[model samples]
Structures are given as structure tokens and as C-alpha cells.
Target: MRLRIRPASRLQGAHRVPGDKSLSHRALLFAALAEGTSRLSGWLPAADCEATLRCVRALGIPVERLGPGDLCVHGRGLQGLRAPIAPLDCGGSGTTMRLLMGILAGFPFPSILTGNAQLSRRPMERVAEPLRRMGAEVHTTDGHAPVFVRGGALRGLRYRLPMASAQVKSALLLAGLYAEGPTTVIEPAPSRDHTERLLAAMGATLERDGEGVTVHPGPRLRPLDLHLPGDPSSAAFLLAAAVLIPGSAVRIPGVLLNPTRLGFVEALQAMGAPVAVAVEGEIAGEPVGTLTACAADRLGPLEVSGPLVPRMIDEFPIFAVVATQAEGTTRVRDAAELRVKESDRIAALAAELRRMGARIEEHPDGFTVHGPTALRGAVVHSHGDHRLAMALAVAGLVAEGGTTVEDAGCIGDSFPGFVETLQALGAEVEALEDPPRP
Candidate 1:
């Protein structure tokens, strides 16, 4: 699972990416929990999302396929999800794990949730500790997965989030759907609200007050028909590729522009990249737009801190790759959340980038990059993180020699067809199935 990508002319094209991963997870899960049939189109048919569909189906909800990328979810409604006989394996999806905890807490079943080794390492305590506050019997493998959430009586309580985490916030909100009383969660800053958006679209009553969000229980969730927009996080790699090579212009059509997810686009603009966001329309009350980027001068180091950190959580790795080509230094702090992702991203990014000769330092929370850099080809590992794989691909696009990435397939968990999309835009990539190492 090694990939070789060589430098080419400006990575150029007008392309549409796969559906947003965050939205797809919440959409299907909520659809299964709502009353009647909910039809979903433009779904991301990837490993992680498919895992959600499978696990929910295992919980006794009948989910049928309409097409390759479409699904019809037959929900058992707010109080009707059947408990699975075995453990609920989430594969490598944290969204499935966290949000499911929130959802399962509403049901009165004792269940176990687990995932792959990579996901097993992620912090489940973020959701575990909160759901416990709502009066659900929740436990975890210390701070990691193998979480047992015994669904029973729940009372929604006001929660102040310790970090800027949409998954944690959304989990609390989703669980709130089943509480006899109202549930509210406050974030220090805004995180993605696709959960709130989808919840409202499904006829659930949800309101935002200041930095906190509240949802009332016993609201009937109606059926929904949706066209999910492309994921900007997945599209960030191509946009980064276009910027690294001069004379490149690429248009990404119909991507989600939720304020919670647009921090990456803003960072590129601040770095002087030629970036344009065209409002195409709206999907499920979330802003949908096309993002265009062109090659530009070196990006300057950035200060990624405070409120801006949560909005761009998923894009930080590629942002780090982009930062390597920028002048000066970039410091990213107040994002200790990075440590809880598929891997210790801050440390992994710094280690892998240093392997390619970038001067970077890792901190407990985040990292700093010293750049306006030049990278030579190197053997890099993805640490089984999808974003890491995508970041390495960008590293190859701007490196002196072609870079070889092991575990490139990890990107399929979030961004399926990632290699094909980049190759279609003239990137030189060869997918190789190298022999397994001892």
C-alpha cells in the first residue's frame, strides 16, 4: 500500500469531490433513529461511512441501498432501535463512535462499541464522561474505545464543553433527543453544526444560544430527502496541490461551506493563495459553494489558535503541509484536541515532515512549522490516519523528487478515490501493493 506521486504541472481541474464525511455519518444515523423512511443521495460510499450503515443495520434498522451512493433508511423512530447481539464495531470512524454514544444513550440497551486499532487509540472519554452526566451508564477502556454505553433513563443537563469538539457537542445533542428533559451543550467556540442542521431538517427542535446549543426531546423526526455536498476537508489536498505549483487553477464544486468548516479556506486566503468561494446554493440549510484556488507566492507562517482552531480541525494536517512551503514559521496552539484524532497528529505530522527535511517541532497540544521549505522524496508512513495519507500526497506534489507513502489506502476511510482525483488533475501517482513487512 505504497504510493508514488511525482511533481507535475500545476494540479489543475474543475472537479466535484465525494460527499462530506461528517454529514453522511450524522445523516444516516439520525435517519435510522427517525420515524419513517429517509432517503439520502450523494452519500460518501467510503469505508468509514459504510461502517455506520452496517452497524446501524445490525442494531435492527433496515437500511437499503437505492444506488451506489444512495440509501433509504427505515428508522425505528426515537425509542425503537433494537440492541445488537454483539459489539458494535465502528471500524475506524470516531464520528460513528462518539455520535453513536449520544444516540445509543437514548435507547435502553446495554451495548459495546469498538473499532480498529487506530480508532481504539482515540479518546472516547470525551463522549463517555459527558453522557455519564446525562445519567447514562457509560464506561470506556480507560480513555480509549471498547466503550460500553448502557442506554436507559436520561436527563438532559447543561454541559460546558472543555474543548472545541463538534463530535462531543453533537453526541450530547443527539443523546438529548431521547431525554425526558431538554439537553444543552456549550462549546468554548463553534464546531461543525451539520448534526444540528440535519436534526432540524428532520423536524427536530434545536436552537443555538450564544456558544451553546440546545435540543428538546419527544420531537418527532420526520423523513428527509437530502443531497449531501462535497467535503471541503477532502478537497483541501487538491487545493493545497494547486497552490504549491504555479499557474494552477482548480475549481471544487458543491462543497460544504459551513462557518464551522471554513477556517481552512480562510487560512489559505490569508497566506495570499488565490482562493475564491462562490455561493452555489444551500443544502439542508447549510451553505453550499464552489471553492477555487490558484497557484500563489509562498504562504506565510500562521497563528492557529483559539476559536479558529475548532473550525479547521480536520484540515490542520494539510494546512501543515501547505505551511511547509510558506515563508517564516507557523504556530498552532490550543488544539490539544489533535492528540485524540486517529493518531497523535501533531507528533506524527512533525515526525513525518522532519523525515522529508521540514523544520518542525511538536508540542503537547499542537506544533510549529519552519518553512518556505523544500522537501525531497522520502519513505513516509501514514500512521493509519486518512488525513496523514492525504497530507503526504501533498508533500509529494511539491517535493524535489517523488515521495512514496506507505498506507495510502487509509485515505479511503474518509476520501475514497483520493488518488484518482489527484491523478485526474495531472498528478503523477502510482498505486503499489507492496509486500507486507514483518
Candidate 2:
């Protein structure tokens, strides 16, 4: 698939993005572990979340699609999940495979977890090593996927995370639910807390004190209805478009405003982008709100590092695009995690953006962008990465000529209606099926 984007005068309007992908994945998984039917509205029905749904059903959990982005998951209780007859294929979702590994570790059954080529390369040992410590027999091909697990008696242990990863922490917590004692995860820095928040909302016995979170073995989880907010990550590209294009103003409604996930928005504000937030309320312990962004007269370069990296880890690709139009230099450090994503994002971003005339330098941990460069359109590759595809498209909006993105079908992995949403905001973008190869 190819996406052709042309320079646009402006992007102006209001739009709502898909449900928060992170929350959607957690909602479905947690719902399946509850004691009764759990209703979820505004769930992201993207490829990634679908992988979780498939795996949940494979475990004998009945999941019914009530409507578009709506679902009712019949909870199978903590001990009710049955052994699957076949290997669980997680497709390209690392979240599905990693978090599910934690849950599968507690079940007294053997299970195999695998995914597509991209996921197969992602390191699963971060998850497997900890599960092994809890008495689950976990094996992986090298450090990658095709993770095999044989459930056994689990004894909770206090483990300090080597790296700050929400998936790793969530996996331990989920496995903790079945351990003989309390399972505690001590983090050097905080990661996204969707797993912690949702678990607590479902009546799991969990506690958070500073950098440590502990979960006690729970008898059962209480099912609850939830309405998820629009994904802030998905909303990020649109917000960037509004900030970079002259005369552009956009209002995005009902976006997840979890403080842990607002690093990107905060970065934009730091760089002089007119970004504002109006808190709507809280749902299932996660904050919900509307975000408004407008083009800035001048955007100064900013520094991104430390604890902020985990908060906006997924947003850096687009952040690189925004940096190209800002004054001075933007430095991003302490984001080595980018190396292990769907693609090596730091390298991919530097290479692809350079094709479009941006001054970017790749580093071991992150990258540096020197900006206010006059960008010209050029063909860029997605490397089968969805976020890179969207970020490249946003770059196209500001380039001098038509920009083409190859292998863009992968965008469906996270943001299904990305192109349509951009068009609605007045961007000249078109999606082509099987365009002639060069």
C-alpha cells in the first residue's frame, strides 16, 4: 500500500480519534478476567486490539461485538480460563503477547505464544525471565518470541525492573494475581499505569507507593462497564498537523489525558505550540479530556529525556516531524527503547526524514533534529511500522511537493481511519491499493 500526500494550506476542524489502543487492549484482557459480563464502549478495533480479542477467545472467553468499537466480554474468572487447543497467534501486537504471557503463566496449562515476523524479533526475555522467577517454566527462541510456557505453582517475589516497561510491569502484576503471595514490581521510573488503573477498577487488590506497585492474589475480579477515551497517541499526529501548518486549528475531543501519557502534549507546549487541555472527567481511574491545538508563530527547540521518554515513547516519530519545523535544535535522549519497537524508530526516523530534507542525527539512545529546514517531498518507507507511516505522512503535509509513503497498510495496526481523519482536517492525502512498483 502507498499513501500520497501533498502540501496543504492548513488543517482546520474538530475530530475524534479511535479509542485509546493501550486502554482498549487492557480493557479486553481485564474484562476477560472478571467474574461477570463486562461491557466496553469505544474500544479500539484496530489490528493490534483484534489480536488480543482473538487470544482471549482462544482461551474460552466469550467475547461478543455489540457494535462498532463496542464489546461485551464474558469474564472467565481468574481460574476459569481453559487450555487452548492451538497455539495463540498474537499477530503483530507485542502488547498482546507480553501481557498475555503474564496471565498464561498463572494458568496450570501449557501454552505457546507467537506473532508475525516483526513481533517475533521483539525481545520477550524481559517478560520471560521474571515469569521464570515466579516458578513458571518459560522458554523463548533466543531472546525473541515463540514463547513457550508451562504453568505451575507461582510464589510472589519483589523484582526491580531493569528497564521501565509497562508491558513488563503489567505482565508481572497479572502473573502476581495467581501467585501464592503478593507480587511487587519496583520501577526505576514510572511507565504507563493503564494496567494498574484498570486492575484496581476491576476490584483487584493492588497498591501503589512511590515507584513500587504490589498486587495480591485475588479470588476474582469484579466486572464493570467502561467507556474508553480517544487515544492520545492516535490524536498526536493530528495535533502535530495543526501546530505545524499555518492557519491550522484543531480540537480533539475525549482523549485519554492520563498524566503518565501526556509527555508529548507537554513537549509541544514547551516548544511554544498553542496546546490546551480541558479535563472532562475520569473513567475507570483514567483521566479523560479534550485537546485543542493551533499553529504557533515560532516553535523553539526543546530537550526530551529522563522519565518523560516512557510517557511519550510512541509519540517520538511524530515528534521528530514537529521538530523539523521548530527553531534551534531538539535533543531526545534516554529513549533507547526505540531500538526494539516494530522498527528501530530512531534509525528509521533519521533515515526517512533525511530523505525529506530534515537535518536529523541518530544516536545510540535517541536522535537530534536541527530545524526550521525547508523540506522537499521524497519517497519514504514505513518499514512496516504504523507510527512511522503516519509521521511520514505528516511530514508530507509540510513538504514542498508530493510525498509518497510505501508499505503504509501497516497503519491499520493502530490507527485504522488515519488517512480519512487527515482528509477531514483538510489535508490532501490519498490511500492507494497496489500502486505500480517502480
Candidate 3:
């Protein structure tokens, strides 16, 4: 698929993005482990979340779709999940595979998890190693996917993460629920706490002490009702488009305002972007709020590193787009993890942005962008990454001519209605079938 985007003088409107992806994934998994039926409202019905839903149903859990973003998961209890008759195909979702490994580690059954070519290249040892320490036999193909986990007796152990990862931390914590004793994870920096928050809401015995989190083994989880807020990562693209185009103003309602996920918003404000956040309320222990962004005359340079990297890790691709319109150099460091994503985002962003005439440099850990450059539209590739596809589309909105992003159908992985949403905000964008090679 190809997405052609033309320069838009302004984007103006009020929009509401889909439910938070991270929360949506956890909600389904937690619901499947609860003792009774769990009702979820505003769940993200994207490709990635669908991979999780498929896996749970394969495990004998009954999941019903009440509406577009509404679901009711009839859990099979912690020890009630039946062994699957076939291998679990996780599609392209790393979150589904890693978190599911944790859950399977506690079950006394053998399970094999696999994915597509992209996900197959992603390392699974970050999760497999910890589960191994807890007495689960886990094997991977050269540290990549096609993970084979043989469940047995699990004994909780204290482990310190080599790096900060919400997925890895959540995996360990989830596996801890089936261990013989308390499982504790110490992080070098704080990652997203959606897992810890949702677990606590489900009546799991867990505690957060500074950089360390501990989870106690439980026989069952209490099902509860939840309403997920709009994803902050998805909201970043709308906010970025609003600020970069002159005379543009966008209001995004019911966005998740989790402090851990607000680094991008903070970076925008510090760079002099006209952005405001108002807290509305809390649902399922996560903050909910509204974000309003308007066009700005100029944006200043900003530096991001260390603890801040994990907080805004998923937003860097779009942040690179915003930097191109800023006044000075924006430096991002300590984000080497970008290399292991669906695409090597550092290399992908640097190469594609350069094609659009942006002054950018790539590094092992991060990238640097020198801005206020006059960009001209050129063809770019999505490299099968959802975030990269959306960020490139944002770049096209400010370019002088039409920009076509190749293989953009991958956007369905996270944001299913991304193009439609952009069109609603007055952007000239369309999805077209890619032309065949001569």
C-alpha cells in the first residue's frame, strides 16, 4: 500500500484517538486471567491487539466483542487455561509474545510462540532469560523469536533489569503471579506502569517501592470494569501536525496523561510549542486528560537522554518530524533500543527524513536534527513499521510537494483509522494501491 500526502496549510479540529495500545493489550490478558467475566470499554481494535485476542482465544478463553472498542472476556482463572493443540502465531506483535511467555511460564504445559519475519528478528531473550531464572525452560532460535517455553515449577527470584523496558518488566511481573513466592523486578529507570496498575486494579498483590516492583503469587484475579483512555503515542502525531503547520489548532480529548508517557508532551512544551494539558479524571488507575495544541512561530532546541528516553521511547519517530521545524539542533541520546524495533528507527528516520530534505544525523544510541529547513516532498518507505509510517506522513504534510510512503498498510498495526482521522482534520491524504513494477 502507498499513502500520498500533500502540503496542508493548516489542520484544525477536535479529535479523539483510539484506546491506549499498551493498556489495551494488558487489559485483555489480565481479563483472561481473572475469575469472572471482565468488561472492557474503549479497547484498541488494531492488528497488534488483535494478535493478543487471538492468542487468548486459542488458549480456551471466551472473548466477545460488544461493539467496536468494547469487549467482554470470560476468564478461565489463573490455573484454568487449557493447553493449546497448536503453535500460537503472534503475528507482528512483540508485546503479545513477550507477555504471553510470562503467563505460559507458570502453566505446566509446553507452548511454542512464533511471529512474522519482522517480529522473528526481534530478540526474545530479554523475556526468556528471566522466565528461565524462575525455573521455566525457555529456548529461542539464536535469541530471536520462535520461542519455546516448557512450563514447570517456578520459584520467584529478585532480578535487576540490564535496561529499562516496560515489556520485560511486565513479563517478569506476570510470570511472578504463578511463582512459588514473591517476584521482584528492579529497573534502572522507570518504564510504563500499565501492567502494575492494571494488576493492582484486578486485586493482585503487588507493591511499588521506588525503582523496584514486587508481585506476590496469586491463585486467581478479580475481574473488574475498565475504560481505557486515548493513547498518548497516537495523540503525538496529531499534536505534531498541529504545531508544525501555521494557523493550525487541534484539541484531543480523553488522552491518557500517565506521567511516564508524557515525556513527548513535556518536550513539545519546552521547545515552545503552544500545547496545554488539562487533567479530566482517572479511570482504571491511569490518568485521563485533554491536550490542545496550536501552531507556533518558532520552536527551540531540546536534548533528551537517560531516564527521559524510556519515558518517550515510542514517540521519538514523530519527535524527529517536529524537530525538523524547530529553530536549533535537537539531540536524542541513550536510545539505542530503537535499533531493535520493527525497523531500525534511528537509521530509518535519518534516511527517510533526509529524502525529504531534512538536516538529520544518525548515531548508535540516538539521532540529531538541525532544523527550520525547507523540506521538499520525496518518496519514503515505511520499512513495515507503524510509527515510522505515521511520522513520515506528518513530514509530508509540511513538505512542498506530494510525498508517497510505500508499504503504509502497516499503519493498521497500531492506528487503524489513522488516514481517516487525518483527513477529518483537513489534511489532504489518500491511500492508493502500490503500482506494480515494470
Candidate 4:
């Protein structure tokens, strides 16, 4: 697919992105492990979350879709999931693959997990190693996908994370649910705590001591009545578009305001972008809020590193778009983790934005953008990454002409209504069928 983005005069209006993708994936999985029926509202219906949904069904859980983002998952208690009759296809979702490996590690059965080409290339050993510590026999194809797991009795574990990863942490927590005794995970820095929040809300006993989080096994997780907030990562694109185009103003409501996920918003504010956040209430132990961003007269440079990297890890692509318009150089360090995402985001961001005429210097860990440079519209590619596709679209809004992003169908992986939201905000973004080639 191709997305044609014409420069917009300004973006204006209030719009909401999809429900939190991380929370959505965890909600489905946690719901499936509960002792009763779990009703989830505002769950993401995108391709990534669908992989988790499909896997749970394949494991004998019955889920009913009441509406577009509403689901009723009849959880089959922690020890009740049946063995899958076939291999579980995880699509292009590493979250689904990794988290399921943790859950499946506790069952007394064997399961094979597979994915598409992109997901197949992603390393799974980070998750596999910890599951192995708990006595689950896990085998990976060269530390990548086509993961095989033979579940059995698990012993409690005490492992410190080499890197801060919400996915890896969540996997260990889920696996800990079936372990004998307490499973403790220590983090070097804080990552998103959605899994811990959701697990605690579902009646799991979680003990927190600074960077160490321990999950005590044996509680029957209760069903959840959840109303998830909008995705902060997805909301970053629209808010960024508002900040980039002069005279633009936009509001995104009901977004998850987890402190760990607000690094992008904080960075934008520090760069002199007119971004404001207001906490509205709490939902299922997670904060829900609204974010408003307006075009700034000038944006300063950004230098982000240390603990903040993991907070906004998923938002770097769109944040890079915002950085292109900031005065002086914007440097991103401590984000080598970007290399292993759906695509090598640092390299991909630098290459595609350079095509639009932004001056970028790519590095092994991250990249630096010497910006306030004029961008000219040019055709780019998404590298089959959803975040990169959306970021490129935002960049097109401020470029001199039309920007075409090829292989952009992957936007549906997270933000399905992205184009429609841009249109609602008065941006001219159209999804076109790609031209055939010889």
C-alpha cells in the first residue's frame, strides 16, 4: 500500500487514537488466565493485538466481540488452558509471541509459536532464557522465531533484567503466576508497569521494592472490568503534526498518562512545543488523561538519554519527526534498542527523512538530527514498520509537497484509523493502492 501525504496548512481538532496497544495485548492475555469472564472495553482491534486474541482462542478460550473494541473473554483459569492442536501463528507481533511463551511455559503441554517474515527475524532469546530458568524447555531457531516450548512445573526465579523491557518483564510476571513460590525480576531502570497494574487489579499479589518486582504465585486472578485509555504512542503522531504545522492546534483525549510512557510529551515540552497534559482519572489502576498540543513559534534542541529512553521507546519515530523542525541538533542516545524493533528505526528514520531533505547523522545507538532544515516532499518506504509509516506521514504534513510512503499497509498493525484521524484534523492524507511494477 501507498500513503500519499500532501503538506497541510495546519492540523486542528480533537481526536482519539486507538486503545493502548501494550495494555490491549496484556488485557487479552490476563483475561484469558482469569478465573471467570473478563469484560474488556476499548481494547485495540489492530493487527498486533489481534494476534494475541487469536492465540488465546487457539488455546481454548472463548472470546466474544460485543463491539469494535469491546470483548468478553471467558478465561480458562491459570491451569485450565488446553493444548493447541496446531502451531500458533503470531503474525508480526513480538509482544504476542514473547508474552505467550511466558504463559505457555506454565502449562503441561507443548506449543510451537510462529510469525511472519519480519517477526521471524526478531530475537526471542531474551524471553526464552528466563523461561528456561523456570524449568520450561524452550528452543529458538538461531535465537529467533519458530519458538518451541514444552511446558511443565516451574520453579520461582530471581533474575535481573539486562535491559529495561516492559515485554520481557511482563512475560516473567505472567510465567511467575504458575511458578512454585515467588518470582522476582529486578530492572536496571523502570519500564512501563501496565502488566503489574493489570495483574494487581486482577487480584495477583505483587510486591514492589524499588527496581525489583516480585510476583507471588497461587492467587486465582479475578475477571477484569476494564476500560482502556487511548494509546499515547499512537497519539504522539497527531500531537506532533499539530506542533509542526503553524497555526495548528489539536487535542487527544482519554490517553493513557502512565508516567513511564510520557517521555515524548516531556521532550516535546522541553523543546518549546506547546504541549499540555491534564490528568482526568484512573482506569484499572492506570491513569487516563487528555493531551493538547499547539504549534510553537520555535522549538529548541533535544538531548535525551539515560532513564528516559525506555519511557518513550515506542515514540522515537514520531519524535524524530518533531525533532526535524526543532532549532539546533537533536541527539538521541541510550536507544540502541531501536535497532531490534519491527525495523531498525534509527537507520530507517535517518534514511527516510533524508529523502525528505532533513539532515540526519545515524549512529549505532541512535541518531542526531541537525534540524530547522527545510524538508521537501519525496517518496519513502515504511520498511514494513507501522510507527515509521505514521511518522513519515507526519513529516509529509510539513514538507514542501506531497510525500508518498510505500509499503504503508503496516499502519494497521497499531493505528487502523490513522489516515481518518489525520483527515479529521484537516490533513490531506490518502491511502492509495501501490502501483504495479514490472
lDDT of 3 at 89: 91
lDDT of 1 by residue, 309-349 (tens): 98899998999988898899888999898987888899899
Overall lDDT per candidate, in order of appearance? 0.88, 0.95, 0.94, 0.94
Q: Give the higher-lDDT candidate: 1 or 2.
A: 2
What is the TM-score of candidate 1? 0.98
Clashes per candidate, residues 3 or more apart or on different chains:
1, 0, 0, 0
Candidate 4 lDDT over 1-438, as tens digits, reads 899999999888999889999999999999999999999999999999999999999999999999989999999888879899999999999999999999999988999999999999898999999999999999999999999998789999999999999989999999999999999999998999999998999999999998899999999999999988999999999889999999999999999999999999999999998999999999989989999999999999999998999999999999888888899999999999999999999999999999999999999999999989889999999999999999999999999988999999999999999999999999899999877888
lDDT score of residue 11 within candidate 2:
97
Model 3 gets an lDDT of 0.94
Q: How far out, in Å, is residue 353 in model 3?
A: 0.5
**Any residue pairs clashing in model 1, and if so which?**
326-372
Which model scores highest in lDDT?
2
Give the number of colliding residue pairs in candidate 1: 1
Which pairs of residues have clashing backbones in candidate 3?
Answer: none
User: How many clashing residue pairs are found in candidate 3?
Assistant: 0
Q: Model 2: what TM-score?
A: 0.99
